[model samples]
Target chain A: MTIAAMQGIVKRYGNELALDYVDLSIHEGEIIGLLGPNGAGKTTLIHTLLGMIPFDKGSIQLFGRTEKVFSHENKQKMGLVTQELTVFEDLTAKENLEFFAGVYGLKGEERKKRVEEALAFVGLSSNAGKTPAKFSGGMKRRLNIACALTHHPKFLIMDEPTVGIDPQSRNHILETVEKLREQGTTILYTTHYMEEVQTIASRVVIVDQGQIITEGTVNELIANIQHEEKINIDVSTPGDVPVERLKGLEGVKNVHVDGSTVQIISTVGSGNLDRVLSLVKETSGVVGIQAEKPDLEDVFLTLTGKQLRDGEEE
Target chain B: MTIFTFALKRIFKDKTNLIFLTLFPVAAIFLPEPEYWPLLPYGYHYFGVLILFVGIRLTGLLVEDRQKGVVKRLAAAPVTHFQYLFQNLLAFSVIVIAQCIFMIAGGVIYDHELHEPLLLLILFIVFSFTAIALSLAWNSLYRNKETSFLVFMCVIIIMALLGGIMMPIEMLPDVLEQLAVIFPTYWLAEGMEWVVMGEDTADFLLINGVLLLYTLLFLIIGSIRRMG
Candidate 1:
């Protein structure tokens, strides 16, 4: 079943268009990873869905209801974990969860039960009484997630929930998200990290300049660009390597030189590696050669013509 | 917890606020009364400024919420904007009212003359709302808490000084006295004068009415969304 659908959505900030004729649909029990560079409308789209900001035109069907204004009941069915750490610093971790649960109308024993469950889910049960002021960045981020989970919303929107944390905490958050999905919670996750999406997102949507450029599962996205093969050759001196000569090789798509490494992307099954190697051997001694399989990073680079972290914004 | 109780916890979490809440009332009570001033008690007049400062300090939590993106998160929650603002404001009023009670109790303990004690309480309660609104409205204009708060302190002190909280308004230059009405502190000082002098009921009520109007205006101005 479709959980939420945004049709022909249009949003503008003053004269600048933030979301232009965008359409996105999220289904039940699926984790959708939203990928975009800074100022590419990912956050804007989430805000529009949550009714935090108004869209200039279009209709949104949330929980199968097409309503311009989000009702209080509809709001209770969804939760958003913002990119920034927004939990109250003065409030204890448990108290923060209770406050948010109470806001969603969870009362009495139910509120207490959910608060405890959320704290345990985020692995902060032992520190429930400790205020966020003393918690590390990772623990605070976990509490931020727990705050949104106390009400147990079916639809969750997490915007870069693991932006700047240690790998262990990031893994914990990812595992928790997977657990939530296993329990039938649909999620819309956005982040700069590509592997996180490759590991967990059931479907991936790539957006740029206020439009959905492409979307699919990780393997499917990589498969679309699988026709190209990336070859990395480590040379004794990369500065003297003739990049233009390699670019002239038949079926070579692109060539990039970084430090002592030279990378050549050529058409798969083109048999151009020998010519590329011979050309590299002419200038510098070859140290190592690696034939790399395409991944989400390459797919993203090929589709958007920009690195995943290019022009990052706060 | 509800927003009101949560807000109370957030306010009292800082240990320094205890000293500000408890010790300041004693200082305000003992402030020497002016011999020539027959309108308002000198200490009570200064207490108006004290309540205003306390109101501003309490409402700074709201400003911090905006600065740190908690308001943006709250916008996505089930609570409406009205619920958040009203509950936080209600919490602030409770704290400010406690300060008022402390001032009244201090008057009794110090054996100071408090004319029309009930009316004086009403005036303090009404002004507390205005002070919260004014502080909230001031906070809406800036994003940084420290800078916004420091600048607000300077502005509020100037307003109090000019509105006769520090000295008699009649002693000011004629032009300054004419301009004093623009500050809500002026109406607050006027209400104190009404309480002390047993002014007519209609005029006394009008002072309260003007203060409420200022509260309404400030609340509207403060409600503008400044979150990023």
Candidate 2:
């Protein structure tokens, strides 16, 4: 079942187009990673879906209701974990959860029970009384997630939930997200981290220049790219390398050189590895060579022609 | 109920705010003054100043919330914009009323006789609403907390100084006295004077009516600017 759908979302800031006729759909119990570089319309799309900002033209349907103005009931069914920590610094972890849960219309013993459960879920029960002012970066991030989950929203939207936390907390949050998926929650996770999406997202949507350039499962996206193998060669005599000679090799799709190292992208089922290795050895004194399958990072680089962390053209 | 609870909790979380809210009004009651006043008791006039103090503190709380992104969090919640404003205003009104009660009790303990205690109570309640509206209106005009606080404090101090809360407006030059009439503080204090003097019903009605008009105007402007 389709849990949420955004069709032809068009948004502009003055004369600049922030989102240009973007479309996205999420299925039940699936973690859809909304991947993009900075200013790639990822945050704009999330804000539009949450009705935090109005779009110039579009329609959003959550739970089968297609209304431009989301009713309070619709908002109650969705949870958000923004990239920035939104928890109150003056309020304790428990108070923060209680306040947000109250905003969601939870009350009495039920509200208390849910707040407790959320704290436990985020592994902050021991420090429930501590204010976010004293928490480490990772604990604050966890509390932010717990505040959103206190209401038990079926559709969770996390925008870079693990942006600047410790490795343990990042892993814990990823595991928690997986557990939420197991419990049948539909999540739309946005991040510029390809590895994060590779680990958790069932489907990946790559957005660039205010539109989705490509989207599919990790393997599907990788398979869609023409490059099947990526070969890296390091040479001892860097100045003696011939760049054009490797590009002329059979089945070599593309070649990039950086100082002493040479990267060759090649097509599948082509006996080009030995030829490329021999050519590199003859041209430049080879120190080490590696050939590996193409992954999502390569797919992103191929489609967008830049690293995920690199800024795109405005 | 949830929003009210949340607002109240937020207001009380800062112990310093509670301390100031309690101590400042009590201190205002003890300022040296003449034994015999012309229009109303010094206590009643000082009570008006207490209401403005509460207004400043409440507005400060709101400014802090906006600076901290709590307003943005609430905006994304299930609550509507109107509901958020209403709940916050309601919570502030409760605090203002409590302060008013403390002022009235202090007056009684000081053996200050009020000619129309019931009418004075009504005037304070109406004036409290006006203060809330004014604070909201002032908050909507500035985005930065420091600027908002500075502007609001300036307005409050200037209004209180010129509108006879700190000193009788009659003592000011004719031009300054005329300017005082343009402020809500002047009209609210004037209403209290009428109540204490056992003035004609028309005089009382006109003063309170102007207070309500100011409340309506401020509320309209605040809501329009905030929603925009």
| Best-fitting candidate, scored by lDDT | 1
TM-score of 1: 0.88
Question: In model 2, what lDDT does residue B117 have?
Answer: 65
For model 2, name the residue pairs that clash.
none
The TM-score obtained by model 2 is 0.88
Per-residue accuracy of model 1 over B95-189 as CA lDDT, tens digit each: 98888888887886787778777788888989999999999998888788778778988988899889878777888999999999999889988
Q: What is the lDDT of candidate 2?
A: 0.83
Q: What is the TM-score of chain A alone in each candidate?
A: 0.82, 0.83
The DockQ score of candidate 2 comes to: 0.63
Model 2 agreement with the true structure over A71-114: per-residue lDDT tens digits: 88888988999887888887899999998999999999999999
